[model samples]
Target: MNALAAELRGILQGPVLVGELLGRHTTWRIGGPAELFVAPRSEQELLAVLHLLAQVGMPWMALGTGSNLLVRDGGYRGAIIHMGALQTMEFRDDGTARVGGGLPVMRLVRQAVRRGLAGIEDLAGIPATVGGAVVMNAGAGEQAMAGVLQGAFLAGAEGMEYWPAARLDLRYRASAVPADRIVAAAILRFSFADAEMLESSVQHRLSARRKAQGVGKPNAGSVFKNPPGQQAWRLIDESGMRGRSVGGAQVSEKHANFIVNRGGARAADVLSLIGEIQETVRGRTGIMLEPEVQVIGEA
Candidate 1:
């Protein structure tokens, strides 16, 4: 790992770290450490780092805001590519917005709302980077990343290329973009609207999300996707899983779909709680819950 880190530092402009604690990067704040971590300075530097990792056949994953992810306690053995510096945002004359993958979704929504853009105002409060949001098709049920996304610049072993929104094959909370192909940048189309109305809509959704999802605790958003003809939270609530805990991890009292870290929660605790909820809900209602949050790393 040291040899690889040294080689990475020599080839890229990013700062490389050994055994960087991943808990600091994720919103849930419960991960272990990454074997190697790099926040590349620019897209070029990111590509260079990827090329080297590929040449040496090392596993790596690009990290965004880490809003919807969980890493196990044993930590990851491969590299973590954090895209924090690619935060440029631009608005064109034709009511379009160009954004970097690392730009925060909150900021993106604010910028669009300020410009009287109506499409992404519904995504106002998601705590995710634009890249991560795009990769997962993040949004509330009424609107999604696919609604505003014209296309994105996807980086792969073949190098970065522009792909249309149709090619993404977006569905409920998921996309076809593979793990290795990072979302570097994207061009999104929006519409002009009354700034006051847009702001009102954004504020309404933000307040609703906070009230429904709860505050004063650390959580990784929704833990499971809503299944066909059913809501996961409703099933969990009906199955008596709300406020249930496995150690420091508990199903949120406010929202049954969320698992929050009460304090000093480990990945094992959350995993155990998730299993219990799935089993209980299935046994009680015959609905097997599917987790929406991405879990990575070794146990």
Candidate 2:
């Protein structure tokens, strides 16, 4: 272990894993290991760790639920700041909910539904954390985190600061949250709705998602972004790449945009299949497919 990593272990109030297997954390169930993985229980602890890392110029990445990431087989060389322990949620006097970064997206949706809050029902079946959703501007149908966000608490070397929704340049599936900064919490504005109506809406969306995109396989949701005026799944289907397999990874037959790990799939298998799909779709349809899933670590 290095001097900085040793210092980090001493200072942190949470469990620090050295050479932690990252595959278990990610939704794809791929990746090798992280040199250092720290999960802070509180915002203060997270900030302190961030300050120390910045002072020493140590590399780090803020990991949420690991929904849309693909860490390479060689593993991540830097520290991973895991946010799974920061799961706090509370309502504000202004009728908005303040949710911590580590809170699961599905849990938040359920809470909102119970409180008769609408707007986030579309995210009922999405597998991610609130921080990841906000950073990626995650959405379905016409609803997105961008539309319901009031403000966000961001932590960095300078400490925590609240930024309004306007500051987070939310494009289609992207956000303006600085890459180096970690999302601490967010204030979301929700509309009052009938409890029964909200519950029904959430259920309907979940059921539709299950049918359209099978919940049976172990997959990382959508792999590619939809090109302008074109859906990614339709394009892949047109290219006849659905059910295509590389090693143990297969393009989901139910949803062409999703890549499922049939069993014992590795990072290399997923990447190879991704490349093949991209090449095939591009060569046939002339539309370049862009990956929505973030690929990290060594190739």
Considering summed lDDT, which 10 consecutive residues are worst modelled in model 2?
1-10
TM-score of each: 0.97, 0.97
Candidate 2 achieves a global lDDT of 0.90
lDDT of each: 0.90, 0.90
lDDT of 2 at 299: 61
lDDT of 2 by residue, 1-299 (tens): 56777787787888888899898899989888998899988999999999998887878999998999998998998889999988899976565999999999999999888888888888888988999999999999779998789999999988999989999888899999998898899999998888789899889998999899884767889999999999999999999999999998999988999999898998999999999999999999899999999999876
Q: For model 1, name the residue pairs that clash.
A: none
Task: Please list the Cα RMSD from the true structure of every candidate, rounded to 1 decimal place.
Answer: 1.1, 1.2
lDDT of 1 by residue, 1-299 (tens): 89989998887777899999999998889898999999888888888888888988889998998888899999988899998888989899899988999999999999898888878888888998999999899988489998899999988767898989999878888888887899999999998999999999998998998788765699999999999989899999999999999998999998899899999999999999999999999999888899999899999
Model 2: colliding residue pairs? none
155 Cα displacement, candidate 2 (Å): 0.4
